[model samples]
Target: MGNDGHIAHLTGPRRPRALSPLREHLRDTFWFAPTAGLLGAVLLWWAASAVDLEIVALLQRERAYGAVRELMSIAEDAKTIVTTISAAMMTFIGVVFSISLVAVQMAGGQLTPRVVRIFVRSRITKITLTVFLATFLFSLLVLTSYESESSAREVTSVPVVQSLMTLALVGLSLVLFIAYVSSTLRLMQVGPVVDRIARETLRMLARQAPGSEDGGDGAGVRAPETGWMAHEGRAGVVRDVHVARLVRVARRQGVVLRLIPRIGDFVMPGTPVLAVHGGTPPRRALLRYTVSVGVERTFHQDLGLGLRQLSDIALRALSPAVNDPTTAVQCLDRVVQILAAVVHRPLGTVHHRDRRGAVRLTQRVPGWADLVDLGLTEVRAASVHSPQVTRRLLAGIDDLLLLAPEERREPLVRHRELLLQAVEQAVPEAADRRFASHPDRQGIG
Candidate 1:
């Protein structure tokens, strides 16, 4: 993807949700779960102990039936003790849970998955200890309630109810928290994969620029479609230019390649800055076939490919003659100027088939052969008049003109024919009309 497309994907749109108090409570109860559970157990034991013996079982024990009955009666009488112990359990649970929660919040809630798993595992040990403690407390409470009969029985249920509610809330919260942590980690992994591939693809597209030129050495300029082979590999246009400047020019751009050079040491392209390694092969394959195909088929092949071909041919033609990179760059500039002139000229004629039809360029320029001859003559004269411009134009041409020395002219003609064909496809009506008017189209040139 391009830079714009990547940014758009990452920061897409907001999502909607439904509000609920249960969900809100669960979210807030990360630390309260264990505490609530313990408190609830304690309160349940107290309530059962505080009830009358006649209300539970007549002789709810063994050989000490009289004693047990009497103790049970006393426990029922002292309901205040049961209520007080239950309230204390609830308060203890609440304070401990609150403190744990506050500590977590203060630590910025950056608990890792491993840490959470450890806590969950430790819960088993914690639960075992709490159960033992609850059993002992229950036994002690029963004994005390039996001994303390004749005191007033207090009626209270707020602690028991609150503790039960807390248990439910905390359980739900932990489940949600685990899910959130898992999802967040997954997203973090996915984000970098997307970004890396996207940036790399964008760089490739930029390197495959349509209108850009790479000037070489002195020679007559040719067009881009002259069958020049790709050698330097591909990179983004901006990145390529930046690499060139950083390596060849002084390192003013901070291109980020780590290799340092001696005063006279030679520099190379793949010396770290241009090379990327160990990318996920599948992602690379997908991008190569799908994304690159779109760029070439839609943009490069239709609009830019022909131009690039011509530029390559022109560069090869001039490379051997020009020694200095600056001179070569100048040569490419001149050729681009010449090509620019032809680009502006209508490659085809536009006519309205119907009033409602859109106007478009057509390939049948009436006297296309004559126009091309005139263009060549004009550029040749201009080249002679302006030596610096000519040199630059020739330099760009030389970079691409080295494919086959003897077959240069033939390839050049073929390249122009391809452009003409492309222009015809771009505007078929003009071509059809021209063919109908002059079927042979033989004497025009």
Candidate 2:
């Protein structure tokens, strides 16, 4: 069916559990690991210094003079060296942070706002921040033990071990800073970002379609005719569902638990988020915990989000103020590939059950047709004026129609007609209309 909402709740086969909010947040947040790791690093260095201080003291007490004698001057200057390095690193961190924020802002404006999440979740960005902050902490800790003196040194043994380690960390951070700069610069480019979005979409397609060539159609007991509609307790996007747990609870209660909101769907307080059929409605607490809601949609299980992201990029490029047709064309290429993958793959559907095959969970997933509408309809409308965008749109639709089954033809034809209508509106001349309607990868005659 063309309508996603038309798919009624029904039971299906069981699936896996989803990550806890705390765990998912830790994974999504850019600073969590780095911040935690920096603290750990500080503790580790402090412990090392504690142990090494005694070793160095013993050597000094014995009037040791071999290798130690050679670096006595270096040790003497350790305080000044560590302090300078710490100050420079902190300053560098401020500058880099400011620049990165600018890049994020530019990307948010130029590309899709969702893409900003990509840059924020970047491993390199997180690592760079961690290194710089850690280096600052390291140098500061080393400075605490910096022994200064006129007659006798205020510090003992210059904390030589700590000095060397701090220097090493500083050097490593420098290398990472250079790499981070290169990565952030690359992120600013339109081509790489479009490709990345497309790649992630394709990856999700593969993940959602894994296991068999069979349709992802789930079969289970019909949802009870009468059921209580469960409303959302909080406002947020339905990020993911712990399906296994849902199926288990539904089976235990001998009822069909129809989750109302699909992953990626935005829900607010009082929105119908679930449908409880039979068996005393599973505790609202259980249902709420089973469904993971968040402020923003994530790429974790929402394949449509990735397509929406690419579509947004294309739309932004085609905007009157932007008017970058070439970028739109580039985005369309990825859209074409994503649609083709969808046609050839299995889409996640509601049909989860336990080992006994008794259907306990009936979930509503955006059907394949719905995804096509999401990925193409908006971009098609936006890019109509650009011949390149129009032609690519036709070609993408042609490819999808070719791969889709006979049952899906009606929806595909409707989409094709919609594209033609958009083409007519965009191109005044018959010759231009004829050229735009023709499906071609290059987008124009």
Candidate 3:
């Protein structure tokens, strides 16, 4: 039993639809944005060319020789600018992104390889790449429309609108370039990367529909004794589950469906995926569609991914190779931030019921104990030698103890005791043990 009042918002009538596999795949890709930009650039060039032709016709009909000469001169300058942009934009893109990728690679190595996913899914990265490509393509297209002869009397059309649009695109690319550079630099830092992961985790938690308390524990529903659905697709991690669809199918078939593996669990082919209680199991294909499998886990539905990532960073920081305790402390700060949010919420098994109050779908979620262990266990073990990490671990547990309910304090207390024991055994000097024993929010001073 968890805090019902604090979790009431999570028990809602509407359940979010599972993100499709294709949609999820596209979201992590860098090419989609640039491809879209190229198409948009083509359309823009067509429209600008049409407008320029209309303006040229209007000026000629008015017999404005002076204005036409001025327009021709502007077009001449426009050609030079467009030519420069078209020739140099791609090279600029290559140089900037090549450096960015190298920096991202180093950061990933310093922290965790999972950090690269943050760079891929970054909106600023995609948008900047898109604008750069669009600018280059627009300039190239505009160049093709420039007139060979530039005499006011003989000038059939002047690309005034096209030139203006190219200039605007170039300006936009420069602005985005600045933002992109700043964003890439932040990715190299530990604090910002950890914060982003934690924020994303909290957002996923907010999106989760925990269902009603009655549905929290399948109180009346009997265990599924009929059959099981095995995984038939290619082996990968379970990324998302179509809970709404599963509920509907179960309700229609008069059965209760329990998901076998959690969202982040990696399953091989022929692995049991669902347990059927009463009625005949749904089509295997239908069950397969409801679960999304990918090569790696993502934040799409994995609630524990953020904590796991933070733990990875902490472990990497404490590793003998890197040996940076300050970075480990930064990781603990964000880990505490994420765990604090989960402390008060309803967790563990969730039940989705139909209108008749019958349980239709039941899925296992990480409980408070599981999450506490996931976040702290490895870090505590690896931090025995690092007094900074040991103190921060104690402080994090103490902070969690204050916010956690009576029932939830057990995990926090257990972790705190285990951390102290590890520190005592690992630290040879009594003074070091005493320093590690004292809880310091900053890990030392």
Candidate 4:
């Protein structure tokens, strides 16, 4: 539906769709496994106890096992033990979680709010949560088997084994508690967080590795004059695009599709999100599923969003309240390293094609100039009086100029001019301005 409540028509043939296994797994990393894994673990342990205990009961019936009777009595005692411990574990989990939350809050306040997602989406935190929940559920289920009435029907032979297993799990939880403390402390620090973000970004770039992937960098490319436009009906960030699936859909429909938004871009409802050229458009029926929209941007696909996270840290460090130029310089160091890898690589800009050499997708990537600006735009503005930040910012620009191709160097040069202008206005002393404007990683000033 259009914004004012008018009918919209889409032209295309309906076709069946399938997902590749890799993309399916990629979707799971966002929010599914953390919660699902916990529930699944509980079900697993319940099933485990049921199957193992039944087999032990069969062995006892075959052999006249007096030891089995003694074991059952111990298991009855173990039931009370597990139940009491489980409740305590619940309280323990609560305290650990509160401490972790406090650490996360500090990271957000000091680093950047956007990076708060990193802590929220952390694998260690997720796994710890799952284990704690699973342990509690396991204990509750085990205790139920020892109910006064159910004890009569319950197998006597397996009590000792079950008790031992629960005891071992308790021990494991203790170990996890120790590790969780260590992990939380690491998260609260600035060095580890920034380094982690940079490494992930570098890893993502290494996978793409220049000419190995099709990133819209085709020459002499222009959108076809005539085509249908598809408007997205929902508002959210473009979390992931099924590029392979989109290519397949375009191949089936025999059309050239142009995507309007890249990963991490926010899409407003009733906005033109894609274009179809030279054939029938696949329309919302096919397009909606191929594009995954969500409330938060993720690092799963958007390399630029990683840059945004890093830049946010730098900008925050430069804030008046923080006034920590050393931290800003550390962030700038990473920003330059990331840019050197990206600006020289193949940026998907113009076209992507199917196996038959037909144009299946088209896109526009952030140009070198725009990308440089993204890295420095805010920090530069805030560095008006901070000579340390200005020097590091300008030095990073120079490093990028040397690393980037000559054509891409234009933006770095322009940024240099602007940084000098800033230095001139803020630092009245010519010596200070000259030192800050110099292209050394550390300013003599």
Candidate 5:
């Protein structure tokens, strides 16, 4: 049974659409935002230059010597300022992001490689980079519109509007730079990174549709075992399934399709990706479109990914070389929080039915026990030597047991016993064993 909930029988095809490959790609890349910013900078410069020309022409026709003189002086000052901005903006972007990346790399090495994904997906980081690049490009374009022939006394035309726009961009970039630096600094810290991951995981949990209580698989309907479709492409992790489209295709074909691998599972070539029950299997191409595969796992549809990342951090922290028990305890705190949220939620196989109430698509999601194990088991094993971690692990398990239902308490109980036994075997001193045995939320404290 999947940890997400019991078998869900969802009627009709009203499920949320999964993120398409192109969108997912765009989300993960750094180039898209800067590229868009560059394009926007070009368009903005053109508009500002046009407006500046119009203002200059009006000033000349009206013979407004006072306004023209003032504007030309502003333009003269702006020329020097914009020139400096254009020259320095690129360097600012390179230096800021370069340092940020190095910090990110160090953080990744210290915690887990998966944390880098958080940095990549940060909106502030992307927006900051975009504005910085756009400011640079806009300033450069504004410089081109400067009137080289105009002397200080006889001002013909001034790039007044363009210069103002350039100044505005520069100010915006400065504000974003400060914000970006603060955000990056927080990302490097253990508390903020773990909190971010836990929050994202809980959001995914909240989005999950409630599952039915009828514990039977497919709500008493049996999946057909007639035909199957094998994956044909290069091996990749199952990122997301376009369930709405799959159900539509299944309903049309008068068949029930069961996905063989759960989300986050890697599929090698020739792996059976879909099982066709009730009728002929749909074309391989159709199945391929509905199931998105990638080289790595994403949080898009994989509910366990957040927990997996948290576990990785905990294990890394507990390693002898790092031996940061407090970091491990922090991770355990989040793990318990995630499990507490999952305890009451229904999780298991999900059944998607057509409008007629027939189960057309079925998927196995992570179960409650699976989640408890994923979040705690590995961390417990690695915490044997650290009394601080052991105490925290016991406290976390005890906390979960208080919230977990009877059926769900088994995993928590089992983990508690295993934790005690491991602590006993590893810590030979009775006083230390007693210390490790006692549950403490703060570990040592």
Candidate 6:
């Protein structure tokens, strides 16, 4: 239906389409209101600038505003002013392009606001660059150098040079952005960690419920053989998690849940939540199975949603108790695999030695290892194994691998050899791992 009480009767009474919340809110605000007020403001400014009207001259200007009017002359200069505004728009676009370059450089958690991944996927840099180029051309061709007097005062060359510099920087930024975006995409494509985890989870549930076509996608399922740890409370972070209870609905459908142990405690791979008593739960129930286990509260809501439905169906067939240690280890291995897949430079490449004889790596963020109960791998990976740079150091401080930005070249290359020695013990494999695609990979970053 149209906005102004226009009713269309076709196929059953049609409901009016409502504006989205964001659009409706914007419509009510001054920022998005109609342009009548803005046009009025522009006309008033023109009147004041044209006649040089003082507080008491409005009546006189109105009486004599027609012949040889200053307003007419000012109106003639509108083209120039609009052109200058276009140039400013160009500069804003240039900044966006520059930011795009920075974004790609830090695609893998190197930049702020982890949500930038969507921006990268949107190809915003290309659109921004196009806008910038169009604005630059318009400003250069139609805005500047419109003067008629040949004897006019000489204009400073600064603005011209600044425009050229802006174009050059934007060009360079585009090159860098393309390179980093490609690299990041390659990394994500190569790492199969997330898919592997999802598949394993489905398989585990399928085994417990035999003769059930509840695999959802009919993908072959297998229970986790290793790397699974059972814990008593929730498994992952609860802050961002979405949970719902399906016990009542599931029970009505003949779902049987055999509480394996303490009912209130969280269950891991080794512990079972319950044995299915009746009909299979829907696969959607798997979504709510996200037990808080990791140190970080990053409970994956999407992962939960996808798995829960399949879990529900599996539970009805042959609900079995969860008991597997391999699941947790598999998760850990997935982390290592993902890191290895994305890293182009050896771990040694990014390390540096400071004046205080300390090794530094800027991006030393540890993975989600605290998912297990024993916390054995988490402790080893995060604490001891991480800090130990070498079996031997100058004074027991192995070389360091600082994961700082590439822009900070001075601090990194200043003491390369010293830093290498410090990190040698910590990452012996890094030395052999070649950053480049060669026969024998070189050591750490």
Give the clashing pairs for model 3.
none
What is the C-alpha lDDT profile of model 6 across 264-354, one tens digit per residue? 2333545643333323533434424423333321112122221222222222211224222223223333333332232222221111112
What TM-score does candidate 5 get on C-alpha atoms? 0.89
Error of 6 at 304 (Å): 8.1
What TM-scores do the predictions have? Answer: 0.19, 0.84, 0.89, 0.85, 0.89, 0.23
Query: Please, what are the lDDT tens digits per residue for candidate 2 over residues 28-65?
Result: 88879778868976896887688557765666667664
Worst 10 residues of 4 by lDDT: 1-10
* Poorly placed runs, candidate 2 (over 4 Å): 1-22, 57-72, 148-158, 209-219, 223-233, 251-255, 355-358
- Candidate 4 TM-score versus the reference: 0.85
**Per-residue CA lDDT of candidate 4, range 11-81, in tens?**
24321232343544444464565468567756766766776577567766676355556556677778778
* Most lDDT-accurate candidate: 3
lDDT of 5 by residue, 73-183 (tens): 888887999999999989888899789989999999999999999999899999999999899888888888877666434654588888889899988998998899899
Poorest 10 consecutive residues by lDDT, candidate 6:
389-398
Give the per-residue lDDT digits (tens) of candidate 3, residues 1-445: 1111122234445544445556766888889988998999999999999988888888888988789888888998888888989999999999998998899889989999998999999999999999998999899888888888766767778998999999999889889989988999988998899989998898777667563233333433586458888888799999887766777778778788888788899999999888888878887756658787889898877889999999999999999999999999999998999899988877777776665556777777788888999999999899999888888889889999999989889989998988888888888899989998888899988
The candidate with the higher lDDT, 1 or 2, is 2
In terms of TM-score, which candidate is stronger, 2 or 5? 5
Candidate 3: residue 400 lDDT (0-100): 94
In angstroms, what RMSD does candidate 4 have relative to the true structure? Answer: 7.5
What alpha-carbon RMSD in Å does predicted model 2 have with respect to the real structure? 5.5
